[model samples]
Target: MNQLSIFLAAGGGKGGEMQLLMMGAIILVFWLFMIRPQAKKAKQQKQFINDMKKGDRVVTIAGIHGTINKINDDGTLELQTSPGSYLKIERSAISLEWSQQINKAAATTVTPTK
Candidate 1:
């Protein structure tokens, strides 16, 4: 007999159901621990990209920092890195987490003028 038949014969038919249960549990755990969070993060990233507008400070995935000069209709943006210096980049290239961190730091680090 083949190894598959020998193994099933050894287990007396309970092994097949047990294997199915284990596979289902593994799929559930994988969805919970991996797929769910990734989908949520992707949704948040899409929302962030849609909310971007002119003059918002942002950091690209490649770590380029700039202010939004203009948002193009073709899924691109004009990023002003410095005075008279600009780079055109895709809207999806912005790093949502890094931009939030920098904006949060800037908001908290403001000083009052005397």
Candidate 2:
């Protein structure tokens, strides 16, 4: 009876260890799949925001399209939608590089050769 009890306790301890290992692995996978990519994206966004300069066209998160007229020392951007028409927006408001190449590609209409 004593030997049997000891064997059962050892088996239970191994099962507990395996459960702990599985939990750790799950946490690691969650970080890898979810947390890590988010961190990397945030870093990239920060870099893009910091690299903003005058004359660079950008699209805001709210879908406003404009040229960066000035960058404030406090991280706010002064954007001009048209001559003398400007909006002050936060650095995070900018969404993507509104490059001329992208605009040109979008403007070209393709017709299928039938």
Candidate 3:
């Protein structure tokens, strides 16, 4: 077992480099799968919020549905939920995917004549 012990001791010196490479690969994969997608989605959401204007239909992240009555310059918006009923919320409170899906379903429900 003397040769085996020498072989293991010699190989132990290279383990640090191998472990560092493995950790780097893991970090790269994690960024590609998790961090990258989350950043992209956040950018899209910010764009969607910025492009909004008065009279736009929207659904908040809290599931509150309303039409935008006014787009305030101070980073807030007034939403009209019902007749004479309104709620003021932040632009970031809107949900991009939910609003888009709800709008899509609405558009598909109404068929036009040829």
Indicate which candidate wins on TM-score: 3
**Candidate 1, residue 13: how far the Cα is off, in Å:** 2.4
Residues 1-114, candidate 2: write the lDDT tens digits: 999999998799889999999999999999999999999988978888877789887888888888999999887989999999999999888885444444556557555678
Residues 23-69, candidate 3, lDDT per residue (tens digit)?
99999999999999999999999999989988888999999999999
Q: TM per model?
A: 0.86, 0.77, 0.89
Local accuracy by lDDT, each model = 0.96, 0.84, 0.94
In candidate 1, stretches whose alpha carbon ends up further than 4 angstroms from where it belongs are: 1-11, 112-114
Highest lDDT model number: 1
Cα deviation in Å at residue 88, candidate 2? 1.0
TM-score of 1: 0.86
Candidate ranking (TM-score, best to worst): 3, 1, 2
Q: Candidate 2: where are CA atoms >4 Å away?
A: 1-8, 97-114
lDDT of 1: 0.96
What value does the lDDT take at residue 78 in candidate 3?
98
For candidate 3, the lDDT comes to 0.94
